[model samples]
Target: MRTTIGYTAESIGYVVGAQGLVSFASQTFFGTEWGWLHNVVDLPSTAYLGIVAVGLALIVGGVKMRKTPQPQKAA
Candidate 1:
C-alpha cells in the first residue's frame, strides 16, 4: 500500500514538474506563458518556480518512500 502510494506520488510529481518547467520556460524565454492549463488558470510569474519546487519535493519524498524496505509480517 505504501509503495503504491509512493509510485502514484512520483508519477504525479513528474507531471506537475513537467508542466511547471514548460510554463516557466515559455514565459521566461519566449516572453509568453504557454500551456493549456496555464491559459485556463492564470498565475503570477513567480508562482511557476514554486510549483516546480513543490513537484520536486514530492518526487523526492516519493522516491525515498519507495526505496525504503517494508517491515516483515510475522505470522
Candidate 2:
C-alpha cells in the first residue's frame, strides 16, 4: 500500500518537473528569462534542480517496487 502511494506521488512529481523544465526551456528559446509558466508556478531557480532530482528518485523507487517479486496468495 505504501509502495503504491509512493508510485503515485512519484508519477506526479515527474510530470511537474517535466512541465517546469520545458517551460523554462521555452522561455529561454524565446530570448526571455521570464515565461508565462512563472506566473502560474513560483518555483525558484535554486529549487528547480532539487525538484527534478526528487522526481527522478521517486520514479526510480516506483520502478524498483515494480521489479520486486510479490508473495503468492492462497485461495
Candidate 3:
C-alpha cells in the first residue's frame, strides 16, 4: 500500500515538474506571444500551482519512502 502511494506521488511530481518546465520555457522564449493564450485563461496561476503540486508530490513520496520498511534482499 505504501509503495503504491509512493509511486503515485512520484508520478504526480514528474507530471507537475514537466508542466513547470514547459511553462518556463514558453514564457522565456515566447514572451508576449504567449500572452494571447494567457488572456484566454489564467496561465500564471496555473503554472504556479503546477510547481507547488510538484513540490507537494515529492514531499509525499519522500515521506512514504522514509516511513515504509524496505524488503530484504536475497543472498
- Among all candidates shown, the one with the greatest lDDT: 1
Report backbone clashes per prediction: 0, 0, 0
- Residue-level lDDT of model 2, residues 1-75, one tens digit each, is 656866786687778667656655655466455434566767656565565666677777777776677787898
Candidate 1, residue 55: the lDDT equals 89
- Candidate with more favorable, higher lDDT: 1 or 3: 1
Sorted on TM-score, best first, the list reads 1, 2, 3
Model 3, 2-75: lDDT tens digits are: 77777767776766656555565677666633323344455664564567566666867756775789888799
TM values, all candidates: 0.86, 0.56, 0.53
- 1-75: candidate 1 lDDT, tens digit per residue: 889989989998988888888888888788887776496667766678888988898899999999999999999
Q: Which clashing pairs does model 3 show?
A: none
Residue 23 CA error for candidate 1 (Å)? 0.7
